[model samples]
Target: MKYWLGLDCGGTFIKAGLYDLQGNELGIARRNLAIIAPQPGWAERDMPALWQTAAAVIREVLELFGIKATAVQGVGISAQGKGLFLLDRQGQPLGNAMLSSDQRALALVQAWQKAGIPQALYEQTRQTLWTGHPVSLLRWVKQHQPERYRQIGSVLMAHDYLRYCLTGELACEETNISESNLYQMARGRYEPALAQLLGIGEIVAALPPIVGSAEVAGRVNSSAAAATGLLAGTPVVGGLFDVVSTALCAGLQDETRLNAVMGTWSVTSGISQTIETGFDHPFVYGRHAEAGQYIVHEASPTSAANLEWFCQQWGMHDYRQLNQWVAALPKAGSQLLFAPFLYGSNAGLGLCASFYGMQAFHQREHLVQAIFEGVVFCHMTHLKRMLQRFPHTRALRVTGGPAKSAPWMQMLADVSGLPLELPQVEETGCLGAAMAAMVGTGAFPDFTAAQQALAPRLESVQPDAQAQAAYQHKYQRYQALIGALQTLQSGHSKEAL
Candidate 1:
């Protein structure tokens, strides 16, 4: 039987899997990858080491299944969005990849915003001035590492870098390219004007050719085949940013559908044909892998990361135990508040995880519950913004690590007052990549056909009306607290400016 491969390159791991065209998952392999913290507010990955690990995992999966390299039809990639992986003339990684958590780019993004660059940027890309975006990181590189920047031949994200390593061609997929802040969303292409504004136009030759997320990127190289155990002539498709692929895999393809992907960070996205954005409240919109469609996304910089942080602080080991302990607590266990800004603000500023309203009687359980509540509350804020702007969403599809927890899924459903549908496949990013491959390889007539065939069975979770009512009251308090926090922030900004 023929098989298709889907690979997911995440911040912490590289996961690969083999599947049939009918969506029966054969096997999945995951290998841990390291994130190097060279300095505070900066995260990176050793690009060469990561590539080797990816190949190792792919080879292992194929061997385990007793399948030859020639049996694989096509390959698709899905990776964490943002970050920069610079390549040299010989297609070698120049240095460690600058991760999405890196803040060295913040100052440059701020300067662009001040110079009216972000305004033009928003008009083109629907993005705000945020750190970890490629535009900000690229500008930082040009200003701070001119010598190293001079050697750069092309810029690729995590998956794009992997694609280049496997295929000799260098190309950027649309979903990730649009997040670069240098790509024009409406026009669906890179902006030369923005590159000139940043004074990096001379090196524009290094930028990857932008292509559809499901388009054929290239054939595998002999070196890649030796390392990954894939056929040399096997086709590799341009993959997508994790978010877009997750949405597609979870069946959030229509304009009226939305998805909540819970991982280290929580991302909320929807499929929209039109761009819905504004000054104070706006979202990044970009073209979908499926032609004529666009994706509208809002992200909470930290969700599971905050949970992980709290677990460490409390010395908890198992998350299942942690969940049970928190669930046993009374609803709204403590009066404490947590803003969950461990990764800084993706929305607005001053969202740091707070322990406000804490009393002398509170314990770790209450604090943990408070943090969980705060994360869910923050998600609800995004949901409100999304629904208000679009107002046509049918249901919210929830996917990823946290979605596996019944308590967490139900709590989110209750807090958001929407039904949460969990995909049959927990790893939608990988499955989405497989779907893209199938479409690109002509196993299916079109993206819609591929989606229909691979769209997993969705497990439904509905809000408990009583629990929903309780969360509604807490949500009001949450809004009031956010307002108060914003006032404090304004006062502080006034002093600083």
Candidate 2:
């Protein structure tokens, strides 16, 4: 029997899944990845360590299922987007990989906003500037670590680096590179003009050739085959950014349906045939995993991670128990609002996760509920912004950690006043990666055919009218609170100066 291997490289874990051509899961394995925060607002991962973990997990899944190395037909990767992974001329890492959540380049982003660099780049790339983007991180390195920047020979995203380790090929996948701020959205390639505007044109030569997500990048080299128990010369496809992979796996084929990722990021996005630009707020227009499509999104680090943090701090190790506690709580009357910005904010870099109206009478349950409400509110904030462009959005395909919680899904439905559907596959990113492999290996004609054969079984949830009304009132309060906070923050900044 033929099989494919899908590897999803995430912020805190590397997951590997073995799947057949029909998308039936044969086996899966995962390894925890450690992020090093040597200083405040920094997230770094050991470059070699990441590749090792990925290789180990792939070997584990293959061994567990007792699958022959020759039986695996193809491989694909889905990884966190926007993180900068640099390699020197000899194909050695220059330093640690900077993650998507790293905020060390906050000052650079702020300076660019002050200097109008963001507006200039936005006109060219249609992507909002962020601290973790390759442009921002590259500029940071150029300024702060000139020696390392000068020696850089290639610029790669997280997945690109992993693919390089496996296939020894230097190429950038389109979906991830589209989010790098270096790519010209309209022209579909790295824009030297944009890089010049960002003052990093000197490194444009460092950018690798772009390849479509499903295109065969290279074959598994002998070393990689030995390390991962895969046959040498097995094809490795150009993979995708985790966002696009997950969205595709959730069956986001058209523009009418939105996909909400409630994991480390509260990401709300939809596929679009046309690129929409010049929004009042920041929204990303990235190339979708599927060719000839765009994935427009409003994303922020405001989702299940908040709940994870709370549980970890409080020693609530069991997720089932935590869900039971949250499920038993009364609905919609907590007067408290959570900002859900533990990682960062869409509002601005200065704003953080907060509770607006905590009272002495409120207990831990109220706080827990506030976290839940806060996360949904954050999703609503992005969804409302998206609705301005995609008013035809009929329903949402919800995925990630929160989809495992029934009460959380219900709250999301009530808060957003939209129907939500959960995909049967728990690891959408891995499944999407496998789809890429299938297409690359000729198991299917294209992504569309592969998707049709592996269509997910879904469970639907609809809005509750009374709960929606309550949330509507609370949403107004949430908006007012945000405005007040922004004003107060602006005032403090002025006062400090």
Runs in model 1 lying further than 4 Å from the true structure = 276-280, 313-315, 480-497
Every candidate's lDDT: 0.81, 0.88
TM-score against native, each model: 0.94, 0.97
lDDT of 2 by residue, 263-373 (tens): 988898889888765668757889987678899988888788888888879887787766786788767788988888888887777777789898899888888888888
Regions of candidate 2 where Cα sits further than 4 Å from its true position: 277-282
State model 1's lDDT.
0.81
> Taking the tens digit of each residue's C-alpha lDDT, what string does model 1 give over 90-155?
788898899887777765666676698766667777876677887678778888888888899889
**Could you say which candidate leads in lDDT?**
2
Backbone clashes counted, model 2 = 0
In model 1, which residue pairs have backbone atoms overlapping below 3 Å? 153-206, 154-206, 339-354, 340-353
Give the best candidate by TM-score. Answer: 2
